[model samples]
Structures are given as C-alpha cells and as structure tokens.
Target: MGSRITSPEDAAARTAPPMRSQITAPVAKMALSSRIVGRGDASFDGAVNIRVETSGLTTPPIVTGKVPAVGSMITEGKALLEITGRPVIGLAGVLPMYRTLTPGSKGPDVLQLEQTLDRLGLDPGTVDDEYDTDTSRAVERLYEKAGYDAPEPDGRLTQAVDAAKAQVDTARNRLRQARAQLDAAKDANVRDTSVQQGAVDDAEENLVDAQEADGEAKFKASTPLPVSEIAYVKTLPRRVDEVKVERGGTVDGVVMSASGASLVVTLKVDAQTAQRLKAGMAATLDLGEGTPIAAKVRRITKNGNQYDVVVAPNRLTPSQLALLRDANVRVTIPVRSTSGKVLAVPVAALSSGSDGGSRVEVLRNGEADLVPVIVGLSADGFAQVAPKGNAELSEGEQVVVGR
Candidate 1:
C-alpha cells in the first residue's frame, strides 16, 4: 500500500460531511398592520320619493316639458319639471311646503326655505322664520334661473289694492272740500259754524277708514310663494332613481323617486372587529375588478352579536357608481398600521430572548448571532422590528427563519 499526501484543505474537505442547505430570508422594507375584512353590499342612502301636485288651476297641470331624466342628479334650486307652463323648482328642506308662503307667513318651513336660498347663493337677506321681501326676491331669482317668472299675488288682490288707493284719494279730496267750506263760513262770520266743523270731522273719519283699507290691501298683494311652484326635498344632489311622469303626462302624486347621490357599502362584522372600526377611518373597497376603491367608515350599528358597518366611498365616477350599485364588495379596514415603511422580518424568525424579549438569529460568516429586537405590529405572518441598544439590523441581511 502506498502512503497518500494530502493538503490541509483536502483533509478538511474529506473530514467534513456534505453541506446541507440552510433556510434563511433577508430583511425587507414593508408596512405591517392587522386588517379587518368583511363582505358587504353597496347601496345608496337616504332614499325619497318626489311628488308635485298643483291646486287651484282651472286646467289640469300637464307636464309640458323639462321633466328630469332617470339617473340624473338633481341639486338644490334645480327644476324637477315644467307643469302648466311653469317650472317646479327643487329645494332642500325637511319640512314640506303645505301652504302658500305670503308676506305674513311665519314658521319653520319659511326658515328652511330661506336657508336653502342662502345656500344656493341667492342671498335671501336674513334667514328667519318669517318670510320677507328678501325671501320673495330670492324666490324670484330661483324662478328666473329656471327660465320662468315667479308666481305673483292673485290679480284680484292687485285690483283690490288699486281700488283702495282710489278710495283714499276720494276721501282726501272730500276732507279738503269740507275744510274750504269751514273757512268760508268763518270769513262770513256765520253764527253756526258747528255744521261746517261737523262736516270736516266726518270727512276725517272717512279718510282714516280709507287709509286702513289701503294698507290691508297692499299687504295682501305682496309677493307670494305658491306651494305648487316648489318642491322640498330632505337632501340635495339626489340621484333620480325613477321618473314616473313623462313630458306629456299630467302632474300628479309621486312624480319621481330619488336617493342620496353617493353610494355606501354596508357590512356586518363581529363585535370584536366592529370595536376596532370608527367613523371616518380610511378603508379600501374591492369590487372584484382588480382595482380597489377608496372609502371611509361612515357609521356602525350593533344588532345582537352582529354589527353593521357602513362605509362611504370617495367620489366615484358615473360608470364606477353604476358598477358598484347594488353589488357585493369586499371591505378592508386597517385598525393598526406602521406609519410608513420600516424594517421587518418573517414572524417565524422571531424567538424569545433570554430575558423574554424578542430576538432574531442573524447569519454572519456562517455563524448565528442573536440580535435583540423590539417587535411592533404583526400582520400577514410578518412583524415590524427595531434593533435594541447597540445591536444593528438592516435590509437584505439574512435571518434564520428555520433550520
């Protein structure tokens, strides 16, 4: 047998067993957080049916034109329809216009009308319960924008006002004539001046009566808001769901039905998840179109063990609204999240340190080094980590996830 000479490297290679593959992963930059997902259906909120019925018309109110189309968005001060050659304007208010608003009309409904006018930038002077000339002017502007004239006080009232003015003039003329007769009697040194003075007194009394009648008639003839000319809706910018009346149809009850313009997703989740959600919290909605839509928490209601979560989506395009309307969607809300990108590692790589703190085994020069770390949010099988004390960890550094 011959003796074999071997170098140190060869001897070491022969003594060492076949190397086994080690399982390791690199540190990554990512956001870590826990998320709550729930299935929900999209729907519109605050639905309302619109009705425009006119009274006191000699002829039936035929919808001549300007009928709003279904799916159209009706905003404040917008015309809903043209009835009897006049526009029926829509205004936002909770109170229905039950009666014609005249100069003396005073109530909560009047205040609502004034406020709606102010919101529309029509400047209804002061918003108050009493309807005044400013409100009437605002109403006129509203009608003007709709390409029509505002409803005026009845012609009969106007004629009465004119008649009252004529009476006032006649009474004044009679008082002047009575005074002239009294002066003539004084000039003639008449013994019985009582008759002339009595005539003057009677004329004065008649004049007072005439003045009172004139004031009353003028007040009755001020600009008036006819209930038939306006429609009150609880919400503005409402989506027209259905149009019950056509152009040539007669104006009747329930001309249209509408709802809130924006769409919301309603979801039911467990109490635990519901507790983590809050109104105005950011969320994402998946419509199964590969693109997620932005949304926010609108409200939450509890019923027994289940809670209802309402999520309001950001402004969606018309096409997007069409796609989401009455469709099932996935809602994801993150209760906790990292502020931004941070150092992270697989949850499997984390282990209990000697002092019960968290630690990761970093591979350096074929040796394992225990680096103490503070664990942050853990999500998706990963945890945000920060090295403790003088220990250092960085991205792309290999960490032992498993043997």
Candidate 2:
C-alpha cells in the first residue's frame, strides 16, 4: 500500500510542483521524431553541420556566445555582487647591496677593503685598510711615486687621491723618458761603429733596465703574496732540498733518477674567477676511495682555452704517490673557503631572463615574486647573493624553483 498524506485536503488534490521548479528554467525539449522528419521540431546539430559544410571549416567566426557563468544566484529578476579581491602577478629577482667603502670602517670592512685594493693592484698596507698614518703615507707615497710628473714632497704623503693621480703622472713621465732615450740612441752616429754600438747598447740597456724596473714594480704592486707563505719561505731559498726520510732518507743528497708521472686534470673558469686559484694556494685534492690528498697549487698555466691548474701534493705517502703517478686517478679540485659568511643562494633557482641578468623568483604568500639579484663567488653549487640596502633576507624562505 502507498504511504498516506498527512493533510486531508492535500490528499484530494494532485501533487504540487517542486520548489526548485520556480527558480529553474525549463530545458529545451529534444524530439526523436525530428530526425525522423517530424514538424515544428528544429535540429541545431543538423544546422551546425550544414553551416560548417558551407563555410569549408577553414574560417570560423571570431566572436561567439559568452562563456557560461561560473557562479550566479538570483535575488529577484536580477542580482548584484562585487569582486572584492584580486591577485597580483609578476616575477621577482634577488639582488645584492653594494658595499660602502669609506674611512672608519673597522675589522672585516677594513680587511675587505685591503683585499680589494690588493686585487686591484694597489697595496693597502699590511692587508689592513685602516686609515692609519702608515697606510695613508704609503698610499700617498705610492700615488706620488707611481708618476714622475707628480711632485714628490718629502714630508707629507697623506692624501690618497692626490697621491694616486701623482703616481700615474710619474709613470707616464718615466715611460716618456724611456721613449726619448730610445729615440736619441737611434739618431746616434752609426758610422762610428764602436762608439755608436756602445751608445746604442747603452741606450738599449737603459731601456731594458727601465723596463725591467717597471715590470718588477708592476708585478710587486699587482701580486702581493700571502703573508703566511711569505713568512714560511723566508728561511728557504727558491730551491730547497727535501729530505724525505720515508723515501729512504736523503742518501748523499743525490738525484736517484727519480722518475714520477703527475696526473693533470684541466678545468675551465672565467678570467675573473681564475684569480682566486693562484699558484701556491693550499687546495685540497679529492682522490677517490674516500681519501683526500692535501695539495698545494704548483703552477697556473695559460693556454688558448683556459687556465690549466697544476696541483702537487704537499704531503703524499708512497702508495698515494704511486696512485697519483698512475694518471688514471679521478681528482676533484675543491676551491678554498673564505673566512666568514658570504652572501649566498641556491644554484638551481636562478635564471638569466630577458634583461640579460640573473633572476630568481621569491615566493611570498604562495605567489611568485620576481627579483633581480647581483651574484658573486659561486662554489659547492651555491652562489653568493648580495644584499640590497636594508632589505636583507633570512634562510629557508620559499624561493621559487621553477614555473
């Protein structure tokens, strides 16, 4: 038996329309008889096929009906709503802050300045850029001495800028003087072979002397050796006899026809990056089998392609030395570490974008924020990202890895 309706009046009447029927429009009816040739029943699919055939399907209409609404509700015949939020979209980059170099910067700042100046071919006295009397005097003296045209005052070599300008002038003058000497020697009497030869030889010698002096000065100015190394080598000359007791103890200080083959691995680095891997630097050599051979940079060779860094073990056991001689041992050159924290970032997430710069996407609030970053020293797969102004960053921030 069918369930009974509670209302007595309702039981007599027919079932009312559904509540949803008031809000929903009636769906257009599809008649099966239309395909079978029935009257008053239109066929949209047939119409579409006919239109497509007539148009050749190559050129379609640019404009069409509006896309279906995503979310809509009716209050009366019409309703109104406001879009209250919007998403901001752009790429972000990470950049570094340019360091300020001025007087009164102490400790690391001074040391950095000193190192930088040293790298730039200027000595900032004792590898310490403090504005002491000695440093000021040395700098001023260097600037003045760097040129001959610049006046060399006996007492006060204090101002750096003036000294630098003076030094350049002096160098120019010396070069001019050397050129004049060479020219005068060329015009000397050639008929008197003996005298002329002697004069020419003298001029040539003078020029060579001046050039050697200049070259030596330039080298000294440009390449300041490490203080510790300099101190270490003070006791020994360029040639030192190594008495390896384990290699059978310096018998007669004789060369026993010692023949050993050194394995050479060549890695390429840019000119700027090559400066850090200078000769005599203590670098670690990773020989396979979980063992590392402590090595010193033997020499840096310049070829057409890139720097060929020759590394020799500072201390090698007989077995390890034999392995090194084998020439098939895989070696990894680890770049030396700096004293303290340098600005650094992940290597993968950086991209060189359209502006011809490295860029990284910073994730803020789950969205990509692009920032242009200045970079420095990249090693161990991590690069140093410089800070810009006061807007520094901390570790573990969500940096966008990719699109």
Using lDDT, give the best candidate's number: 1
User: In order, how many clashes per candidate?
Assistant: 0, 22
List model 1 lDDT by residue over 204-243, tens digit each: 9999999999988887787788877788998898988889
- In candidate 2, what are the lDDT values of residues 1-403, reduced to their tens digit? 2566367668545576544411111111111110000011111010000000112112222212111132211111111111111100010111111232223334554454354435435556677745443343433433343331212222222343345545556656655665665566668733444544555565556556555655434322332111111011111111111211222122121111111123333344546556666776665555455576665656676766665555566666777655554343333444544446654556776778797877666666756656667766566556666544444444555565533
RMSD in angstroms, all models? 7.4, 37.8
lDDT of each: 0.88, 0.39
